[model samples]
Target: MNPPDNPSANRWLVTACLAQVQAMRYTPAGLPALDMVLEHESQQHEGGGERLARASIKAVAFGPLAERLARQALGSCWNFRGFLAAGRGGKGLVFHIQDMQNT
Candidate 1:
């Protein structure tokens, strides 16, 4: 399968998303304020194992407005980026931008 491109590949986009997400202060509302290249990081342990790893999570805002915006942004980069929730402990959401054209 081919990876998707990042909507927030541009610094401006990332900054905009980050700022908006933070300003919104609500996951549902904040989600739309960001570009599609945004991903939430989550940390967890494996079953019966003393190992730690990151996991990718497909996130969707719990509201119609947010979901619509998120979907719109994500759709643009769906072919170049993977929505992953950081498995490692972190303070906030991490946006990983990929160069789909290069890949």
Candidate 2:
């Protein structure tokens, strides 16, 4: 089935810590790109019980955001605003970060 055309349909926001960051790379079109992983941990109520939630997700940022993220300290937490898209080779989801703010 075709996906919805609404721009907000793919929006994603998460609070996480920077886990890993690869060296800055330039796309063929000369845009700065940076790939990284974000780790999140929290306690949530599930099934009427408290549970610890954790996740490590792959993400990417381009242009100025890429340059800014590349300079952030590892393990620092931030509120990430972005959208999800297929990863390389359609393997898995990759978060396309649009903005970030201190958490």
Best by lDDT: 2
Query: Could you give candidate 2's per-residue lDDT for residues 1-103 as a string of tens digits?
Result: 8879886998999999999999999999999999999999999999999999999999999999999999999999999999999999999999999999999
Instruction: Write the residue-wise lDDT of candidate 1 on 26-70 in tens digits.
Output: 454353332333332334467865554433432223334343444
Candidate 2 lDDT at 25 equals 98
RMSD of each predicted structure: 13.2, 1.0
Model 2 lDDT, residue 99, Cα:
97
Give per-residue lDDT, candidate 1, residue 31: 38
Q: How far does residue 25 in candidate 1 sit from its true spot (Å)?
A: 19
Worst 10 residues of 1 by lDDT: 12-21
